[model samples]
Structure formats: C-alpha cells, structure tokens
Target: MSKNSSTATGTSVSSRILLDAVTKHYPGQSKPAVDGITLEIPAGKIVMLVGPSGCGKTTTLKMINRLIEPTEGRITLGDEDVTNIDGDQLRRRMGYVIQAGGLFPHMTVAANIAIVPKMLGWSKEKIKNRVDELLELVSLEPAMYRDRYPRELSGGQQQRVGVARALAADPPVLLMDEPFGAVDPITRQRLQDELLRIQEEVQKTIVFVTHDFDEAVKLGDWIVVFSEGAHIVQYDTPERILNEPASSFVEDFIGAGAGLKQLTLNRVRDVELAEAVTGSPGEMAQDVLARVKEAGDGHAVILDENRRPLSWPSRRQLSRLETIPATPDAAIPLVTQGSTLSDALDTMLVSSAGAALVTDRRRSFVGVITVEVVMEAITRSRKASAMANDNDSPVGTNTGTIEVQGGTT
Candidate 1:
C-alpha cells in the first residue's frame, strides 16, 4: 500500500480510556444527560460513541474532554486523573474536532490552525512548521491553503483545516464530533479516507462520535452504543457488535441492514498474507535456491521477471529442469492494492491457497498479500471509521435474511 493509500497500518500508540460511572445531569432534568456509564477506550485506537440523537451519545463523549463536566464518577486518560486535571491543560494535550471544521471566519486557514500552537507558545518557526505539517497531514497543501481565509474554502476544506488545527499541536488524544458531518457524502468518504491515513501515521487516542450506525461499524476499534440518558447498551468491536448485539435496543438502533453493514467493516480479504518472497517463474530450481536460500518451506513463489505472480513451485518442481506447471494454488491473485482490507482477506480465505496475489484493478500483481496485511488493513479501516459512520454496506454479509436481535428487522 502507498503510504497514503487507504489501507495503511503502522501504530505504536495504545489509545486507552477508563470511565468509572461517568454521569452528567441537567439541573431541571429528571434524568441525567449521561447516566451511570462506565467504559474504556483502548490506547492508540479509535473508539466510537454511536446512537440516536436523544441517546446521550454526544453527552457521553463531551464528559471525557470535560466539555460537559460530569456530575458523577471519574474520567481517566491513560493512568492520569483527567477529571481533576486542569481543563485547559488537558485540552491542549487532546485533539478536539467539531463539525463544519469550526474554522474562524476572520482568520486565515493557517492562522486558524495556528491557534493551539500559539496558545502553547511554540516558537514562531515551530508554529509555522507545525502548521505546514498539519496541512499535509490532513491532505491539504500548505502553500495553497496557508494564507487563505476560511471563507474562501469549501465546507470539506474548512473541516480539513479544523482537523489540521486540532492536530497542529500534536496532542496524544483526540475528541471528534461528527468531523465530517457537514460535507456531502462523497466528500465525507474522501475525508474519512484521509483521516484514516492520518491515524495510521499518528496513532493517537481517539474518541469519535457519530449518529450513523454504519459509520460506527466502519471506523471503530470498539463501538460504545448508547440510548436514552447515555445508557451504554453495548461496547464491543464492530465484528462482535454485528455478530452479537447487546440487546434488541442496540439492534433496532442499527436498523434493518446490519449484515450489509458488516461489509463496511470487512473487505473481500483479511485474516491472511503472503510472505514477501518470490522466485523466477521459468528459472532452474537448484539455481533459484542459490538465489533465495531461506524461503524455508521447500517451496518458492514463482514470478515473471517483471515481478508478476506465476505459480508456487512444488518440491519436485523446485529441483526439476523440465518445466512443470505448479498448482494454480501456488500463485494467488491479488485485487486492488488499496481495495478494502476485508476484500483482500476474503479473496485469500475463498482462494484457500495460503496466499493470494495482490493486484491493482488492471490485474497486475503488486506483491503477495497475506492474512497479516489483511488484518492490518482491517485495523486501519476500523480506525478510520472510528471517527466516521458506517453509513454504507460491509464486505459480504449481504446475502439472505439479516436477523435483527437475531430475528428479522
């Protein structure tokens, strides 16, 4: 995958959160805006808060950042007591993103992005570099957008700037509230991909909130489903949530197409990989052994001189001088380099031949894609969806009846 390709997975951070009976109440309300809810967000990962509008999902999210002070319980980040930390100090170290980019109409994009850095009193050179870095990080060109005012940009651009601004100070934690909510669907998806790429490179602890169930499934490392008064109906991985819901409430909320929703979290392939080793398709085997001495398993992946997959050699073929076509299973076909990780995984699983050839849409082999890469891609895709919504279909669950609450919706 290209560094910027949709499926990049390299992370060292462990994004974790611990909330002990966190609750928020309005003065006149009979029930808490956020009821007694306890949850954990794993470190260096994206945890999504998803539910209906009045479900207190947003309220649950805000309490973590102290945007809305919890009326009860504690919020902890890593091992620190976030509830007691200085709110301003806590915020500076955390990334905050809201809908429509929240860019200041009066400020240039660079200046809007520079707000956090300037507050942190970073040196002029430091802030300038940070601003530039953030623009590129969010896929916005620095030279193109730095001097432009928010009014001059489109909604998506503004949101990108907002994200750039939130990430400007390089906070270890991120709080996102529908960061892509204000844009058109296509633009939202593009932004979602861009954010995924960014998360892969930056590995921050992220808490993302979305109203869409599909978005929750697509982007979450773990999803926390809420209902009236911020009740946590379920807190689990997207796969688990799809396969096993917390209750009928959770099922009803996700609605009629949960199986199709599964595809959003899955691709044609995941769960496997092909080792990064190859051999010449038509070369002499005893000679090829001299080239790749440690392929280990008494077999070598045969490739054309141009690096396209040909076949996997049998032990006999490994020593034979005469040409014998190896099992087609020897060489697996790869789909697009950045096709959904689930698709690649599905291809590998369905092919059932150890590994599959990873190719672009043109059917040219890029390299071998194994289950490992597919899993990594799944991780990245889920992380990307951590901040977005699973608003579309999943990988392949779209066949027959989709039982809601284990029954028909």
Candidate 2:
C-alpha cells in the first residue's frame, strides 16, 4: 500500500460515489438484503443513511469499500469502477470506523494511529508527523496521549483516537457506523461537534450509518432515508426532509417533534446572546456586586486573566466574599458559537442559572444564551419555513444528481 498518485500532493481529493442498481442477496434469504438502489453521494459532504433496525443500511455502507461484496450491480468511486477490485486494497484507500473505537488494546495511541501509514510504507518521520497532526485534528494533544495505551484513556478519548486512526492516511472518503453510539450523551455531543469542525477543514466524502435521526440531522449535509430492504424512501437535505416528507412512512420516522428538531438545523451564532455583568479574579467583590445591582442583573460572571469564564455567582454569594475566588464551581455549562440551539437548551436545563455560557473557539466567554432566546429562534424558524413552503421554494441544496429505481422517492 504505497502512496498513490491521488495522495501525492498531501491532500485528500474527495471523490463522488455512485451506486448503480446495487443489490446484495444472501445464499438462503428469499429477498436481497439490499434491493436495487442507486444513489449519488457528492464529494466533500456528509451523507447519512438512516433506517429502522435490521434495515440494510450497514450492508450498503460495507459494499462501498467492498467489505460486503454486492451480489449484483456496480459501484463506482469517482470515475473508477470499484465493484470488482480487491477488497483489502480497496479498503486501504478508505477510512472505516465502528462502534466503541474498535481499537486494539495492546497498542498505544501513537501505534494505533500509525497502522495505516506504516502499512503504506511511509517513512518513520512522516508517520510520526501524520499521527501528531491527526491527534490535534481530533482535539487530543499528541504530546500527552501519544504514549498512552487504549485502556488508559477515557471512552471519549478512545473514540477521538479511533477517528484519528481512520484519518491517518488522509483518505478521500470516510465510513462511520454508529461511531458515537457507545459514549455518554455529553461526550457524544462533543464528538459530533469535533467531527463537524474536522469536516470543515478536511472536506472528506463521508458516508455514515446511524439509527438515530437526530444525530443524522445534526451532522448530515444530505440524508438518505432507508426502508427495510435498503430502499431509498427519500434523499434530500435535513431541512427538506423535515418540512416536506415524501410519504407517511417518512413522516412517522420524523415523529411528532419535527418542529423541535428544527432547532438542530440552526446554530447558536444565528441568535443574539444576552450580556452578563463581568468581573475579574482578585477584584473587589463589593465592586462586582454594585455593578450587578446597577445593571439589574441577578448574577455576575467572573473571568480569569485571559477572559475565560471562571464562575458565575449571584449578588448574595458575591457579598459574602472579599474577592472572587480563582477557582469557583467547576461545572459551567459552556457551548461554542457553532453549537445548535438544541444543544444550548440542553446545557441551560442542566445549569443552575437556566442559561448556557457561550464561548469562542479559544474557550473565551462571549455571552449567555437563555431559554427565551432559543424559543424566539424556534418561532422565527417556523414562520420562515412556512413561508418557504407556501411559496413552493426548494428547501435544501442539491449537491449531486440522484437516480432512484423501484424506491419510494
């Protein structure tokens, strides 16, 4: 597995995928696991495949890399027909991730990430650099994690490393099958954010499989709704899928909270945040209290030297202390500007102040997002979507041409 001409420039050239009447029929089954389905996945975008349990979504994903050879039809990557290629060689050119990281316990973090690069016969220096670069890309510090074993890391850390490993060779396409399902809710959200940030930088063609519709909505630029036999019920953007359901099955899949799911489409940056009275550590508590009262704010946010939020305390708590403590309560619900309003609402619900603290990319506090702000955003979104619907305007962008045969939509 040497460096191919495609990667000689040290950048991934994301390639479009084409499935032409692809079908998979097992030996004993009466019906094919995946019926003849044709879909075109655009380059440099995240496409989610979602369906109910026992659907052939996972089988469809495996077919792309030849992990599960299609019994009929052709598969194409960019201009090349990969349907008949060697499975091992084809897989080396694509990144695949599964649940719980699928990491080898005996290997260290650096060793795990270097597996693909090493197989590609990269120089030792080049492999080291690539490992560190991917680690940073996934928000893990290479210096601190490179030497640690898989058992030494938290569940979230392991998942990050797994992603780093998948990206080790800088493949043009990535395949993920419920990659974040094993983690806790908070960690899963963080991972989703990290994936979005990384996708912005790398721009890989991603095909992800998930049973969770909310996760699909949050991450997918395009989504393919599948039925029992890998049938394409609908293929479109998240906005269109929510606003214009092709059929009753699609509507039921969306559920009753379609309006609430709209929050997942908008980011916190779209709405304005409320300003909070601010103070620095070592500042006179009385001065902060006076400012809080002057502004008629219930609480004041204490900042560190770098303008990062330290703690948020009320007027009564500020009065009891002579100066703000360098370290206050450690649990501050923080969200970045790119976070969705739904994420902010989750944060606010857990916070004692009923508001989530907004931060910049560097974790510096910017402002606060309250429940009122989210509600207003939701109202505005509904009104706008209704207008779009009434006018018969298209909802989402069509990145590539789609062809469906014997499917619902």
Candidate 3:
C-alpha cells in the first residue's frame, strides 16, 4: 500500500471498533431508528457514514461512544467489550467533534483543549505543553490563538480548536459529525485538506458522519452508505462504491459525473509536477529571466529568505522589473502535496497562469502544478477505475464486515 493508502494495520496507537448486530430503537417509535447493523472500523483508518437526512448515520456514530445508548447488540474496541462500560469512562477514551466546533464561548482556546487532560488529572505543566502541541499540529500558532476566546476566532479556526480538544488526550478513536458542514465552501475545503494532513501524522481510528457524498469520497478510507433505518446499502471503498453501485438507490445518491468524482481519489503527490525557474527576492530580474528562457519556461517563482514562495511572475512581468520584489504576493495560489487533484484543479482554475504552486509541509515551494498535469491525472484515473470495474480480480475490494468470535472481531 502507498503511504497515503488506508489499510488494516500500521503504526497506530489506536484500536479497531466493531459493532455486531447493533440496533437502536426509540421509546415510542413504531420502528427502530438504527436497525440491526454489523460493521468493523479498521485501526487508524477513516470510516465515513453517509446517507440522506433522517437516516440513522448520526445515531450509529453516537452509539459507538454511548452518547446514545443502544437497545441491542455489542460494541467492542480492540479486545475490550465497551457496550456496557461506564459511559463517562468510555467517552474519555475516544475523541468526539460535532458541528460548528461546539466550543464554549467563555473559554479560551487553551482552556478548551485542556478540558479532557485536566479531567484526567494531568499536571498543569503537562497540560500546557499538550495544548501548545495540539494547536501547532492543527496549523494554528499557539502563542497567538491559545489566549483568545472561542467567540474571537473565525468559524474555521474554531473548528480547528475543536479538533485539537478532541485529540487532547491522544485517544484511540475519533468521532466527527459534520464537523466542517457549518463553514463556507473555501474554508471547508481547507479544513478537509488540513484533516487529511493531520491524519497522516496521528493515524487515529476516525468514524465520521456526513450527509455529503462528495465529502465521504474525499476523506473516507471506507464509506458506509446507509438507507433509512440505517440499512447497509453498500459497505466498500470509495473506488468500488463509485465504479460499481450496489443498487439504483446508490446510483442516484452518487448523482451525475461519477467520472469527475474519481479525481478526488488521487493526490497531488501522485503526479509529476513541472519544474519552474526559481529565483530569490532581491535577485536581478534579468538573471532570473535568462534562466526562464534557458529552461523554455514562461514563468519564474520568487522565493523569500526562508525559501518559501513569494510570487510567481511571468517572463513579461520580470522584464519590466530590475529586481524581484521583497514583499510576498498574497494572491499566489498554493497547494500542499497532500491536497487532492480535485483541489489542485480548483486552485489552478482561478490562477491567471493556469497553475498552482506546490508546497511542502513547511510551506516551502517545491514545484508547480499546471492544468495539463491535472487533466492527465483525471484521464488516467478514469481509465484505471474503468479497468478495475471490468476485472474480476478483486484487487481493490474492502468489505467492511468482520466476523465476531470469542468477544473479538
């Protein structure tokens, strides 16, 4: 498997989650809210529960941590039977994030993240270090944001803090319920990209619930399509779910342009980025233009003192200037290697040069992703998906069902 690929095993500090014949029936309802469902969430992999409104996806997620008690069946985490465990104790071992961050307006960012650790009786010094570490992990500078109240932060920033709080105790499992649904489209995309990047580092077992099918395709290693009453419409990888719909219900749920959706499966690192002529700020524009001409390139990427991208100027723009500008261009399009091809394409579409700059984890410029590269990636992905669907080899199959035996699955 690739570095970004999801598997059953890795260097995960997490445990697998299993639900066997789990059902949740309401007090007075004629039918159960969540019918009998059996599912296995692999260690360190993200499993997404997706369906229309009124479906039991959210109910199923809450039952894992016993936020809502299950009327029947077993819930196991690793080797332990947690179905009947103390609800408060069980919840402390898992991280949960909900819509709009669910932050308390009165608390500062550091205090918010320190809730779980403090409840666990961690020392003040330890909690402080943890808060700073988590804040940095979520791409927020600790010193600046830690002292601010939740009401002072933007919607996306508040969501990042919520995630930080959930991971405060370094729990083995994470449960998210439409965590990014409340944000604007652009911020939502950034949050998705940030989540993927963070998952690469933490590798926790994440069970996410969303009504958006496209969100499921982008974030989930395994997707569980749920019908009304929480029936398992299809439990499979995103690739299989898109290429081979189990029923007409799934086909309509996927809606139009299944081929276009395949672009979400691949990442920017999967393709070879085109190299651009690079120069530093305060460097002679004539020298940089010479290198651009020698390389047969139309643009040159300007770098700051730390080797971070500052601007991407064309040959024409460079010819009129004597030296590269010291100030960074706020409008420069940027994407990280972990970003999906779909996101890279979106960034490039709004760029005047029809390309986006590729950055490393440190935000340093690596290369350029052009429209042609994205188009080629989309084409290759379509062909690969088609070929996989035609073959009977079961190469990419991931049936999320595990047989329970001896109190374990």
lDDT of 3 at 6: 22
Candidate 2: which pairs clash? Answer: none
Range of the 10 consecutive residues with the lowest summed lDDT in candidate 3: 1-10
Models 1 onward score TM values of: 0.65, 0.89, 0.88
Stretches of candidate 3 off by over 4 Å are 1-14, 284-294, 315-326, 385-409
For residues 272-386, write the lDDT of model 1, one tens digit per residue.
4345556654555676665455665545667665556667555665666454343355334445444455444555676675555665433345556666655555566556555
**Per-structure clash totals for the candidates:** 45, 0, 0
Report every candidate's CA lDDT: 0.68, 0.84, 0.85
Model number with the top lDDT: 3
What tens digits encode model 3's per-residue C-alpha lDDT throughout 125-226? 999999999999999999999999998999999999999999999999999999999998768878998899999999999999998898899999888888
Candidate 2 vs candidate 3: the lDDT winner is 3
Candidate 2 stretches with Cα past 4 Å from truth are: 1-14, 279-291, 302-307, 322-330, 385-406
